[model samples]
Target: MHPAHPLLAVTHPDPYPYYAALAREQPLYWDKTLGLWVASHPTAISAVMRHPAARVRPLTEPVPRGLCPGPAGELFSRFVRMNDSRLHTRIKTLLMAYLQAQSQQACTPQWPAITLLSAVQADRFLYAAPVHAQAAFLGLPDQLHADCAVQIQAYLTALPANANADLIAAGHTAALTLQDRLESHLLAAEASPALRQLRDDGARDGIPAALLAANLAGLLFQSCEAGAGLLGNALILAGRRSLDASTTPAAARTVIDHVVRHDPPLHNTRRFMGNAIEIQGQRIEAGQTVLLVLAAAAMIEPDNAWTFGAHGHACPGQTLARSHAADALLHLLHAGTDAHALASHFRYRPLLNARVPQFDFSKDHQP
Candidate 1:
């Protein structure tokens, strides 16, 4: 039987080949075991994403009920990604405008890039640089970068449907820790304009302080999770192509765009049926799950598909994520080491939606 589970794409080293086969054979099919409809073709995925009947979460459950009464659940409930309400729309607009005002250089690194360039082992730098870039952008203190990453990973692990008890517990602990820290930081962080804006804007919009805190934390979680993966993928691609740090900004941006098109940081996301619908002859009842196979659709047409998302549901942080990744890759190329050396040995963190890379240079003294 064909591997019907989306997690299979996460575990397999090169799932593109499998995705190609599946896309050609069953572009849109129901996986009885998974209890979700998979859409592999670009057109089909786009159709579903923009469909009037599509939603980010189930209509009956606005937030994930399974994770509620805890920090993770609370954050998930307020997360812009999980809601379709008018409040979410207004908040997302404000966030996007804030993100758009940031120049590429503001998001990129210079001193850290130079530091990573001089490391005896670039492996740690490869991972650390992206983490630092994201942390800085989110107005997180440098001292908490490591702890923040750990907590974000825990939350990420517990996001999927089949997460175990251990994962859930860890996520809960991490969420509480993150919540406390974020709240404290927001209260005390008068120096950070972005945080201040989020607070002021949210208040002006009549949003509760707690929800504001959760959304701010959500920004950090997104940065740590997806931002890291995009940077890692760019490094791997540049290493393969022998691209150097001296590459022009325009050139670097092109490479970043290609990477997003070909091997995006996020492979897939799910949507719930908002109303009874017929998609490609398949009758999907309201509340049925639809897996938007972004990676698979990218295989078919990397240019047009909703790699980030579609219509009103698109990720507002796309530009920020790409700029950070491009800057890191430019520096990694200039780091005076063949970063490609690690490309062959690199491994991915097994995640259904994310594609973060993990590297260990201790085993091989490449530098």
Candidate 2:
């Protein structure tokens, strides 16, 4: 197979077979068309992500120039996700400590009453649930969860490369709004344990106040669509397997794990090399980009998929992400709505790295 063959993970429907081909034939081959090295093997992908020399992006331009000169741009520049090892570790420590302190109830969702006709409602609820969960986890006010979710979603949608002009504009506006909200929360003398711990620990750790807000926004941005996709993919799988309310939670968890391995919400992430590194004896030059096929890696190596980035650049919110995903799936399964009822109407949002569901259940559509 030619590396020049289109490997458009985003637009291409069912890229698994293509990914499998790479895993079998060229686990560490460079794709000329994508202008990046593709890492499909667990060992290679882990090495790249965990490598000391591996950078989230080029140090010369941490955040894209186009996003600079704005609040959203500022946040992107300082976000731990894009920073070097030192800063990333600091922020990640503070963030993960705060997240882990949160009670299980805070991150869990109360499943909404659902039906075959509940597709639209399900879509809306799932979209908002993760945002609310994040808000609750951050010790923010429950009253503003709805508005906060919308702003975060807008901000996240405009984050990827080659985003539309309108989307970028909307994201900036939402960023400013969130900035104001977070600033107000910090101003108050009374703070929840989670927020208090974050501020105190972050400050002691030398994390700037402004940087904390930016990263918090970053957390929200990541959670918004990911939560939706996790549930959406699980629903599709459940429907195919004919799972229902009677299915045990343990069984539902198995379904979630399988989906994460096969059809993860975030399919791919990019990493840049800061120094020459060798992966499986292949010399990767400095400044070269490596694409981590997360989904494919998971399928090839089951253990690593569940604990993505376990060694280097671990997802600080991995526990919460898993809990949220499992909760969403359990709720849907317990809703007792037949998966088949929603199968034919399944629709996905057009996103580069994420798979978001957009339900289109009309009044005229019968179950």
TM-score of 1: 0.79
lDDT of 2 by residue, 1-367 (tens): 2323423554355777776676667778777777888887777888787788888888677877656678778767777777885777778788777666755334433333355536777677667767777776666766777788888877776777777788788878998888777766654578667777778887787777777877777777767777777778787888888888888878878877877777777777778888899989898999898887776676676666632455666677766777677776777666666766766576666565666666664542211
**Which candidate achieves the best TM-score against the true structure?**
2
For model 2, the superposed segments whose C-alpha errors exceed 4 Å read 1-18, 104-126, 245-248, 333-338, 361-367
Candidate 1 global lDDT = 0.71
Q: What are the clash counts of all predictions, listed in order?
A: 0, 0
Model 1, range 69-142, lDDT digits (tens) per residue? 67678778888888887788887876775565433225324324344432234444544565566666766666
Error of 2 at 321 (Å): 1.4
Model 2 alpha-carbon miss at residue 153, Å: 1.3
Listed per candidate, the RMSD to the true structure in angstroms reads 4.6, 4.0
Which segments of model 1 are wrong by more than 4 Å?
1-7, 10-27, 59-66, 102-131, 158-170, 184-195, 244-252, 360-367
Worst 10 residues of 1 by lDDT: 102-111
Please give each candidate's TM-score.
Answer: 0.79, 0.84
Alpha carbon deviation, residue 183, candidate 1 (Å):
3.5
